[model samples]
Target: MLVRQCKSNFLGWIVPLLLLSITVHTAALAQCSPGAIICETFGTGTRGQLPQGQTNFSYRAIPCPNDGEYNVMDTVASSCHGDAWHRVTEDHTAGDVRGNMFVVNASYQPSEFFSQKAEGLCPGVTYEFSMWVMNINKVLQPGPCDEFSLRNPIIAMRIEQTDGTLIREVVQPAVPRTTTPVWVQLTMQFAIQTNVNDVVVKLINKGLGGCGNDLAIDDIGFRPVHPTLTIQFPNSTATETTVCADTRLTLSVGAATGYPNPVYSWQQSQDNVNWTAVPGSGQATYTINPVRAGRTYYRLRNAQPINANAVGRSQCSAESNVLIVNGRPDAPFSIGDDLALCEGTSQVLRAPEPLPAGTTIQWSDQSTNRQLTVDAPGNYWLETNLNGCTYRDTINVAIQNCHLEDIYVPDAFSPNSDTVNDKLVVMHPGTFTAYSFRVYDRWGSVLFVSKQADTHWDGTFQGQPCLQGVYAWTVDYSVLNGQNQERHFARSGRVLLVR
Candidate 1:
């Protein structure tokens, strides 16, 4: 038995090579490579049914139909394609196209075809279409030998524009005649001619029928030869930095090259792992108004690529670095609403202690010190600036007056032992610090004197009752002014002494 494989170069020439029987047998177990944008393995759905996202080509042979025009089959039948058909499973290169494989036969005409439409392809972008195929022949009644003469079959793969114009076409090496079928892997690389956004990929089995046009293909894949997509911050420092609360931050994406026109979206995350899209952030630049504190992570996500083959989505997306922001502290101090001071005294107003570092204190008088002294009263305030934020508090102050006329003294007292009118006293409206009262007789001699404010004068001289007559009295006292300063007060008045 002879086995051959073919490869096409950039110029579209088929280069054939020979393989030993042992090498051909070992090739049945080959697996599909990774990185395909679309891989139709036909692993889903029941046998004899069409796979999802695919349909049979309109062209079909009318004469010798044995089953549905297009069907998926399992590797349970011995005479279906070849003994090696079961080895060609979906991802595995060997083992009957993994679970189920696509099948088409040319029972009436010399060929049969199946096609599917592919959308969102980049114009003039090179893509590789790959699949595995095997020839099927009828088995005799007593054994797995062919009932008719053995024949080789050819498989052609083509990409056509929506209008059915061919863009590129390549035929796989013919499947050689053998008692047991052998699976061959085929790949064709092509680019769309014009700006075609949609194209049809068709796989056709071109071979003579009688009993030899049956073909089983599996593990189809379509992908770009080179996939490119990238996202980065224009300013490297913006990746990991800090910001102030309510500050607006603008983040822009770095220039991306090689990828087709790509769509962008901005996202934010607190943990840097789970991300959510920021509304209205679908442009190349995004802005943030951080009204709160704590750390936030941001990244630019490549949402859709002009070339569908490019990779940039959720886990595979390009992300920016992290940002940490801080908010302003609360008002630090409480200045009482009202403050009082004497007319001639000064009072010092102090700011709250243990102030935060980098704090700036300003007074209503434009003083930068943390303490201010005021004598004249009106309104005073203090403003503190910390971490780029400001807070203020105000106080009202009033001045008080102290006068001598505010004190009153009684003019007369009787020493007759009656409870009423038995003592001489001085009365004042305000608080006094010191007070003294003195009484004199008609002969101009001092009779009684008291040093305490609450003490009173009784009508007596040297332990003898003085005659009841007019007596002279003098009183002195001191009171605190508005500024807490003391002022002296004195007065003299005549009083009548009665028995």
Candidate 2:
């Protein structure tokens, strides 16, 4: 049974004798939330149709267990919604004990045979059929009487009218049984009419001959099909397009339509298959914000319009163009490189794209020096006001800001239990590849050493606490500056280890 949004909370009905046209308002549809459990169980006796059976039709009653395991089977036999049937014990033999119903391997197959006997039958109504089968396990292996040979066993159902005419017959797929002697259920569905009073529901095993394996059956019902709407976007093919990088793109739906007023949403996927909705894309004609400069595909999704109070499933549309962005210039242009003097100086800027022969070129940094002085840190770039089209490129410049940067220390300290800045710490910030710090007492005795400068001495030497006094410190280091050039420095100093 299909689920749809209705004005009321619960709508349960047996289909009427008239085939009524259903009108779906797109505005009343909504997306079904995750993890919803829906069940449509037509009552017993209204299930399973009558296939073309030449002989007897029978049903048996069964016993309910008291193990208190009120799970699917337990609850089904005992609860209000528990409409499942049990096996009849009175028809059991020595091997087929009481409370066991068996379906033998006769002419049982899937979707092949059907029976119809219409003494009371109708049109335009819906019906449901359910059956119970259990293993008697009377015999051992595969034979004419063994249910295990019941390969591809299916049930075929049909409804016949008074004039020997076939009204409706539903052939359901067959089920395979295991060696375990448990009960299994089969269900079938059909649409019927109201004038039908003495309509027949047939249960025939297709494929398996009359002497097929054995199982039992019971309880059927007739119920109504729920209100649902399905929509599709016709003749739409996924396409790909190429555009320049970082360019905003607009995608349009091509040759597609929906039943309900369709709401549009846009989704993107880098790879052609997996797609996700773009943020803030809950409207039609979506605009890509700061469009990415790459080959990205987008899809258009259509949703069923939702009414203020309706809640149901929303249908989806197909994907759209795969757009690409291309950059300009086609290749990287070069500018002439020149060196500056005085150690920390910088060279004037130049544009690789040729300029007028007499144009005055200004050095970047606003310095009139067509050349930069060797002193500080900064970046350089150039621009020329030619042809009204501004062309520019920037080269980064860095200066050595930290120079007296070698390790230094004080020589005396008092560890007489007073607190102040009392430890020797090697400190500097930026990137470092490797470094070592060493501290020596008056006699040139190595008191502490560390590869990591952050590790400071708290008046401790070689696991034993040392007395606070004067300490000599020395450090060696190498640095890679912002330009990725390496330099080395070594320095010695005195540190007052105070306490």
- What CA root-mean-square deviation does each model show from the true structure? 20.3, 22.8
Error of 1 at 487 (Å): 48
Which of the numbered candidates is closest to the native, going by highest TM-score? 1
TM-score of each: 0.42, 0.28
Which candidate number would show the highest lDDT if scored against the true structure? 1
Q: Measure candidate 1: CA RMSD.
A: 20.3
**lDDT values for all models:** 0.58, 0.42
Over the full model, what C-alpha lDDT does candidate 1 score relative to the true structure? 0.58
Looking at model 1, report the run of 10 residues with the lowest lDDT sum: 1-10
Stretches of candidate 2 off by over 4 Å are 1-346, 350-354, 357-379, 401-405, 410-421, 458-470, 476-499
lDDT for each residue of candidate 2 in 300-357, tens digit (9 for 90 to 100):
5553343211211221222233433222111122344433333455444444544554
Residue-level lDDT of model 1, residues 329-406, one tens digit each, is 534676665876766988889888877788888999999886899898799999887776666788988876535347
Global lDDT for candidate 2?
Answer: 0.42
